[model samples]
Target: MTDTTAIDIPGYKQGTWVLDPAHSEVGFSVRHMMISKVRGAFGVKSATLVAPENPLETTVTAQVDATSLDTKDEGRDGHLRSADFFDVENHPTIDFVSTGVRIEGGDFLVDGDLTIRGVTKPVTFDFDFGGFGADPWGNYKAGATAKTVINREDFGLTWNAALETGGVLVGKDVTITLDLQGALQA
Candidate 1:
């Protein structure tokens, strides 16, 4: 087994960072039934990462376009945007604002409030440091990944169809993954 403590990169100066939307992705995966899994991604409209003097207390705020959701299948994507799910017409964006952040050994934890369909709930995402580097354009870039599992029904997204086999059409738990790339703002 690999030691996670060795994965951390050196911390940078305290400052604000802007997410590189072109390289960052917010995606999710969930069981389609009792067997298969379905996946989708939402476009990141804007994001800001606020690194405190002590990197461990970093803060992240992001807004995702609800209508920009895309999956491999158009029909399924349409359904996800409907009232049965996200109801894109009503909730035009999905937002997250971090409340607390901390680092334990080599791993980081980002605790935040996630709002969906007007319902707000506290959620924690495990953050993995991906180090900071310079881009080809001379921009200072930083990379990281965060993941968490949330119950769809907990946010008022309880719509579902009973499967003939005995399970529901949609899975209750959704695995959210975030691959983020940020550029420090001088």
Candidate 2:
């Protein structure tokens, strides 16, 4: 039998928390023309995380502005915002809401509903808790790195083209990386 009794974990903290977007980054990369990879980042608008006094009972929710997507390339950015891709005009935001969390090995799996371009899909990300510390200002802070890969088409991002030499202009698989910092709001 498994112990359902809640126990305080050494590094776990409870209460409302805010994502420090200035210290966080949302990045993604996908194969371009099957020969090169294009990478980009979106500025996080707002995020919040809550724990029920125990890390095992936690909830996370985040929202990101779709228009904040930047690749450092104007042409590509515009293309990505067009109907061929994100269609930002219609869907102005991307969001994630955690449904479950499970620890495996030394890491965690964050299972959530990821919505993009009005399409929602179940996504699971591998997460690493980077411990907790206090800042000079006396605020508690924690960090985490999470990553996952998904088919862009699954989120309604179906833009692509056949290269003259071989494969399509854009690859279907997109790898997402989230480097996050959270401020304890307890």
Badly placed stretches (over 4 Å) of model 2 are 1-9
98-133 per-residue lDDT for model 1 (tens digits): 987766655678889999888899999998878888
lDDT to native, each model: 0.87, 0.88
Candidate 1 accuracy as TM-score: 0.92
Candidate 2 positional error at 52, Å: 1.4
Give the alpha carbon lDDT tens digit for every residue of 1-186 in model 2: 223446555677778889999999899999988988999999898899987866667789999888999999999999998899999999888999999777766557788999999999999999877878999999899998999999999998887888789789999999999999999985
Best by TM-score: 2
Question: Poorest 10 consecutive residues of model 1 by lDDT?
Answer: 1-10
Candidate 2: RMSD over Cα atoms? 2.0
